[model samples]
Target: MLATRLTALLGIRHPIVQGGMSWASSNAELALAVSEAGGLGVIAAGPMYPDDLRAAIARVRAGTRQPFAVNVPLYNKRAAEFLDIVLETGVPVIIASQGGPKAHIGRFKEAGVTWIQVTANPLHARKAEDAGVDAVIAVGGEAGGHPGPDEVGTLVLVRATVNAVTVPVIGAGGIADGAGIAAMLALGASGAQLGTRFLLTPESGLHAAYKDLVLNAGIGDTAIVGRGRSPIRMVKNAFSAEYEAAANRGADDAELDALFARSSLRQAAKDGDVAQGKVEAGQSAGLIDKLEPAGELVERLAREAEAALSGAASCIR
Candidate 1:
């Protein structure tokens, strides 16, 4: 296996990280499995109450002694409370995303929790470093769920952010297999964070229908909706089509919010309501054809990345 700054910094055996996909990642089973497999498993702390967050943390701790993280999307109104939960529970790592981390970085640092901020562009990376974040996760537009308005892909965004910031940059978006991991490292990312791939893992608590949609879908199957706000990448279902059409026709913020409330990601991931619920998935969904155990997938990715790196190095000789 290959080691990088990310593995050393996060105290994980591999440089792979399972993204904290809200609703889908609320269950600690997948996180625990990934951590046990030597990769960092981050629990989704977004859209959860303080008590629920506490319970999720407890579940992870009960499952594994290895290091893990909790992703706090600042867009969540309960973000501050979630941070408090992380601090109170002594979570080893906290990933701040979806908004500025200026307010919470200091507190996280003071509590000795490793703070990794998620950025979608070079400016965000610089700002995160200024906020004193321990690391930066550069999420590109191709990523599933909310990837911000910027349309930069993972390859370009990762390289640019790595050049712009002094902190270690983790590449996200469109990454799935071992080759993708190796490619990102070559572009200067310390590691890769995968959202779609892990969502398809057997340990993930997402519904079977959602996993089937992802497995059968191609790269063109997913589309980005919600133009007025942070666009979310989701499968092209009836709900997505209606939402996109309404947004294109000048739907107000209130209308959009209503639509979101009616067809939230939680419904899609948990209830398997593909026609009405938001099926969030990255373009990497095309790369994955089957659902396997998280531990098996992690080991497979490590082996693939190691072989890919070895092959690339052979060219120099």
Candidate 2:
């Protein structure tokens, strides 16, 4: 197994962390499977109601005593309630994002909860570390579901964030397999978090159509919409095409914002409205070809990473 700072900090066997992708990871199934496989699994709290969040947390706890996390995007209106549920349920780890960790992180810290902040840039990583987070996940624009707006890729962003902060950095974005994991560890990241790769797992909560689209998507099949506002990377489809055409014609903020708000990830995830609903996914979708069992994928990834690292070292001798 891969042992690094992330593994030691979280007491997990591998340094691989499942990305708390909304819709994909909203349920307890994916998180439970990964954790049972000796990797850190995370329940995404973004699209869940308070009751559902509480229920999911209970399910994960009931499923495994292993350390699992709940990702709560602070920008959501129910973030406060989600945090309350996380604390009330005694969830061991909290992965926070989309807002500064100064205020509420203190409360979680007081309760002896391990805090991991998701940052898009080096500056945010530094701020989160200073705010007392145990570690930080630096996700670049190549990731899905609100990657860095600055459009930095994982290579430069993770290295820069590592230099900018002393805390263990978990590199994310455009990572799909064991090779990606080895690359992150080589670049000084203690661990690697995978979003899109995990989405292809059978345990993920994605709709059948949603998974199919991502499976067939190529490297260039994804696009980034809404620059300078709230950029999202997703599969190319009718909705993205319309947005691009509007932007090309110089649409104003009001028009673009309305268009953006009209679509939702839930539409695609829940209702199978892939053409119009925001099918949020990372560019790594191109790398995914089939659905694998989450538990098996984690174990396989760890072995492959170990082999890859060994191969790299052997080449030197």
lDDT of all predictions: 0.89, 0.93
- lDDT at position 311, candidate 2: 91
Error of 1 at 200 (Å): 0.3
Q: Evaluate residue 280 in candidate 2 and report its C-alpha lDDT on the 0 to 100 scale.
A: 89
What does candidate 1 score in Cα RMSD to the true structure? Answer: 1.7
Query: What lDDT is reached at residue 233 by model 2?
Result: 96
TM-score of each: 0.95, 0.99
- Candidate 2 residue pairs in clash (backbone atoms < 3 Å): none
For candidate 1, the 10 contiguous residues with the lowest summed lDDT are 223-232
Model 2 C-alpha RMSD to native:
0.8
